[model samples]
Target: MGHVMQVYLGDKAQLEGVIGSKDEALLSRLLDAAATEDAVDPKIFRAIIDGGPFDEDDADEYTAAMYSICSILGGQSIDSVVFHFRSCPDIADIFYDWAFEDLLPPPEGSGCAIWTKENNAEELAERTADTGTDVNDGGEGDEVDDEIHWMNESLLAGKDLIFFWGV
Candidate 1:
């Protein structure tokens, strides 16, 4: 596959299986157009009103994250989650453990993808090129990792969560 994205609306039960996806009809419809035009559908307002599958509420922040993800696909930005681990091995370790090794018990209702099972080789290679990292690896990954960590953390903590990912 050239490039693909698989978004999740809930937690990985054991680094593999996930709960059902509730908002694909909403997110997929929005991103399908946003991918090309770098614009967001008005439906985003509704998604914001409904609150996140997680707890992130500010539509502007989520919008920035969403468009930033689009920027990565267009080569205008480095992949956020990918560069996070490449630069800050320590912080990356915390996130990575949650991603794979299960360092923290995943939040109960958090929407997250099981990268090992879901990511194709092309995406994996891109994520862990292991060559070099952005000058501000810690800073760069902070946004992406924070989005993911707390979403999962909320689930583990039994709080509202959201669906978030990028290719």
Candidate 2:
């Protein structure tokens, strides 16, 4: 059988399905190119954006489109893609559920672990503490308030990137 090529936006909803080895190679190459540079080429980006069939009610299609864009822009693949815009605390819990409930299996590894933000934050926080949260906490010689403000601003500016993947 010939190679089958499926294009998905962000969710698994298929945008275009083509049959040909060459087409499959081209698509894979495009994805690789986008993933490498942390940016998608305008031509490829426009192609994906314009190629989908119009379906206003299709949430899956829109989600898939976002994923396609992310994939093109170096986003990794997880079983499900959960988007958290504008930084909410619940975002971490959402990711936790995705990992433990959807992706991770029991100790025997019966199921796959999905990606979520909870796990990421927990890990990040732990690492931050381990690496020394003291840098943010003012020492006796430095101004504590200024240090706190600077840390807060830095964290706010360092927003998490919108994509992740598990191999």
Name the top lDDT candidate. 1
lDDT of 1: 0.35
Instruction: Please give each candidate's TM-score.
Output: 0.21, 0.25
Best candidate, TM-score: 2
Give the per-residue lDDT of model 1 (tens digit) for 45-92. 234324334333433334333433333333122123333335555433
Worst 10 residues of 1 by lDDT: 13-22
In model 1, which runs have C-alpha deviations exceeding 4 angstroms?
1-19, 37-87, 98-167
Q: Residue 79 in model 2: shift from native, Å?
A: 11
Give one clash count per candidate, in the order shown. 9, 15
lDDT against the true structure, per candidate, is 0.35, 0.34
